[model samples]
Target: MGVEGGLKCVKILLFLFNFIFWLCGLALIIVGILVQVSLHNTFMINDAAASGVPIVIIAVGVVIFFIAFFGCCGAWKENYCMITMFAILLSLIIIVEIGAAIAGYFFRNKLSAIVHDSLTEMITNYKNTTAEFRDSVDNLQKRLKCCGMNSSADWKGFASDGNTVPDSCCLNVSSNCGKGAMTDPTKIHQEGCRNALETLLKNNILWVIVAALVIASLQVMGIVFACMLMRGIRSGYEVM
Candidate 1:
C-alpha cells in the first residue's frame, strides 16, 4: 500500500509539473516573438544570425508545448508508452537547448565586433540613408550620449568641417553646439556608440541565457518524475 501511494504521488506530481511546463513553453514563445521584433524594429539590428536566435527559441517552445501536453496525458492515464515517449522527447529538447545556449554564448562574444561594423557602415552612409534611419541615428546618439562609431572623428566625411559632429552628440544639445567641437569633451560626448550598443545587445543575450537555464532545470525535474511514474506503471502498479 505504501508503494502504491508513492506511485500515486509521483503520478500527480508529474501531471502538475507538465501543466506548469506547458505554461512555461507558452511564455517562451511570446518572449521570443517580442525579442525578435524589438531587435529588428526598435534597435534596427539586421544581423541574420542575431535574428535567428529568437526563432530557435520559438521552435523549442512549440515543441515543448506539445511535449508537455503528451506528458500530462501520459501521467493522467498511467500509460507506459506515452510516458516513455515523453521522457525521450524531453531529453531531446534539453539537448537542443544546450546547443542554443552554446551558440548564444559564442554569439555574445562576437557581438561587439558586429555592432562596431554595422554602426560604421551606417555612419559612412549617413547622408544616403532614409530620413527615418537618420532620425534613429540621432536619437541613438542622444540617448546613449555617444558621438560616432569609435569617436567623433568618424564623422569627418559626413561633417564637411573636420572638427564638426552632429548636434545629437552635444552635451547640452543646443543648436550648433556640435559645430567645430568634435574634440571638445566639455561640450560634446567624445566617446563612440559601439560599446554602448554592444552592451545593450549583451544584456539582452543575458536574459535569454538565464531564461533557458531556468527552463532546462525545470524540465530535468519533470523528466525524473516521468521516469518514476513510467517505472510504476511498467511494474504492473496502478499509479492512478
Candidate 2:
C-alpha cells in the first residue's frame, strides 16, 4: 500500500509539471502572435524601419513555444516516439540559437558602422534645412513692422505685394514652417538610427544567448522528466 501511494504521488507530480509546461508554452505562443500583429500594424502606420525587432521576437517566441508544447505533450502521453521527436526538435533550436549568436558577434561592428553612417546623413540634411528656415525668418522679421493700428491689418497682402517682399519668400510660409515645427527632423533621424542598432544587439546577440541557455537547460530537464514518465507508465501497466 505504501509503495502504491508513493507511485501515485509521483504520477500526480508528473501530471502537474506537464500541465504547467503546456500552459507556459501556450502563453508564449499567444504572445508571439500578438507581437507579430503589432509589428504589422507598426509597418502600416509608418515606413518599413519599424518592423525588425518585433518580428525577430515573434519568431524566437514561436520556436520556443512550439518546442516546449511538444515536449510537454510527449511527457504527458508517455509515448517514446513523441519524446524522441521533441528531443530532436529541442536540439535543433539550440543549434540555431548558437549559430545566430556567433554570427551577431562577428558582424556587430559592421552593423554599428552602417547605423552611424545613416544617422550622420540624416542629421546633416536636418541642419541644412533648419539653417535655411532660420535665415528666412530673420529676414522677414527685419522687413515687417506692424504697430498697434496696423497689427490687425492684412499683413499677408502687404507681404505679397511685389514692392514689399519677394514672391518666393511669401509662397506658403505656413506650410513650410508648420512641417518644420511638427517634425523635429534631427530627433527623428537619431531615434531611427538608435532603434536599428538596438534591434541588432537585443534580437541577434543578447536574445540568442539567453534563449540558447534556457532551451538547453529545459532540454536537460525534459530528458529527466521523460524518464520519469516512462517508469511511471511501465509500472502502471504492470500493476494493472
Candidate 3:
C-alpha cells in the first residue's frame, strides 16, 4: 500500500483500539467505585489502611482514561506530541501491571495466611467489637458459605458453651444455628473462610494477570502503529 493509504489504515486502527481502551478504563473506574461503596456499606470507611486498594484502583482508572483519550486524539490529528505522550503513558501502565502481577504471584501463598490471621483476630474479638464489625464478618462468612477461618474447629477457642460458630456459618441459616453447629458437624458449613477466600483471591488475581496481558498486547500495538504513522506523516510531508 502507498504511504498515505498505510497511514490512514494505521490511524483507523489506533482510533478503534483507543476506543476499546477507553471503555476498559471506564470499567476500571466503575469497579473502583463499587469497591469503595462496598467498603462504606461494610463500615470500613474509617480503616484508612484497608481503603488504599480501592483508592489506587480509582487512580489507575483515571490515568488510563486520560491516556486513552490522548491516544485517540493523536491518531485523529496525526500529532506526534500526543502520540509520544500516549506511548509513554502506556509503557508506564504496562510496567505497573507487570509489577503488580509479579507481586501477587510471589505473595499468593502468604496472602491466604494473612487473611486467615485477620479473620481469626476478628473472630477472637467478635463480641467486644462494634456491631458493624461483627456484621461484616458474618456477612463475609455467609457470602463465602464458610465457617471459621480454618474450620469449625477454629471457633472452639472463641466459642462459649453453646455457640461454637456464628449463625451465618450454618448450613441452614437459623437463629439457633450457632448452637446447632456446636452439637452436630453436619449443621455447620464444611468449608473454612480462609480456603474459600484464598480461592477467590487466586481466581481474581489470575483474571487480573490475564487482563493485563491483553491490555499490554494492545498497548504494544498502539505504540508500533503510532510510530509507523509518525514515519509516514514525516515522509509524505518531506516529499511535498
Candidate 4:
C-alpha cells in the first residue's frame, strides 16, 4: 500500500510537471510567432546582421520548449506511442540546437572579422581623403594670404577662379559664400558610415524569424504530450 501510494504521488508529480511543461511550450510558441511576424514586417536583414547570436538563442529556446512539452506529455500518458514520438521530437530538437549553436558560434566570429576588416578599410580611405583635403585647405590658406583680400577690383576674378577658399576668407570675400561654406565634411562621412552600418546589420531578420517558428512548434508539441501523459497517469491510477 505504501509503495502504491508512493507511485501515486510520483504519477501526480509527473502530471503536474507535464502540465507546466505544456504551458511553457505554448508561451514560447506564441512569443516566437510574434517575434517572427515583427521581423517579417518591421525588421530588415541588416537589423540582425550585427547580432545573429540573439536570433540563434531564440531559436534554441523554441526547440527546447517543444521538446519539454512533448517529453512531459509522453511521461504523463504512459503511452508508449507518445513516448516514442516525444523521444524522436526531443532528439531532433537536441540535434538542431547543437548544430545551430556550433554554426552560430562560428558565424559570429566570421561576421566580427568581416565588420572589422570593412571598418578598417573605410577608416583608411577616410583618412586618406581627409589628409588630401587638409593639404588643399592649407595651400588655399597660403594663397589667400599671398593674394591679400580682394577688393571690388579683384572680386570677379576671385569669384571666377576655381580655388576653394576657407569660410573665413569666403566671408571676407562674399557674405553668401560664408553662409553655405560651413558644412562639415567629416560629419557627412560619419553619418554615411553610420547609415551603412545600420543597413548592414538589418540583414539577419530572416534567420531570426526561422528560429522563432521552430520554438513555436516545440511549444505546441510539449502541450500535447503533457495532456496525454496526464490522462495515462490518471487511467493507471484508477486501474491500480
Instruction: Return whichever of 3 and 4 wins on lDDT.
Output: 3
Tens digits of per-residue lDDT for model 4 on 1-240? 654565555545555654655565455455445544433332222334334445545555666566556665556556556655665665565466556545544654455444445433333342245655444332332333211122112112233343322333332443344332323332111022223332333344334445445544554554454444445455555313
After superposition, candidate 3 runs with Cα above 4 Å error: 30-58, 157-159, 238-240
Worst 10 residues of 3 by lDDT: 42-51
**What is candidate 3's lDDT per residue for 28-128, written digit by digit as tens?**
66765665565445423243433454555566667888899989988888887788778788888877756645654655556555565677677788789
Best TM-score goes to which candidate?
Answer: 1
- State the displacement of the C-alpha of residue 85, model 2, in Å, after optimal TM-score superposition: 1.4
lDDT of 2 by residue, 13-108 (tens): 544554554554454345445544432322111223333433443455567666666666665666657766765675675565455445445544
Lowest lDDT sum, 10 consecutive residues, model 2, at 146-155
Regions of candidate 1 where Cα sits further than 4 Å from its true position: 172-180
Which portions of model 2 miss their true places by more than 4 Å? 1-57, 120-208, 227-240
What lDDT, from 0 to 1, does candidate 3 have?
0.70
> Positional deviation of 35 in candidate 3, in angstroms?
7.0
Name the weakest run of 10 consecutive residues (lDDT summed) in model 4.
146-155
Best-matching candidate per lDDT: 1
Query: How accurate locally, in lDDT, is each candidate?
Result: 0.85, 0.43, 0.70, 0.43
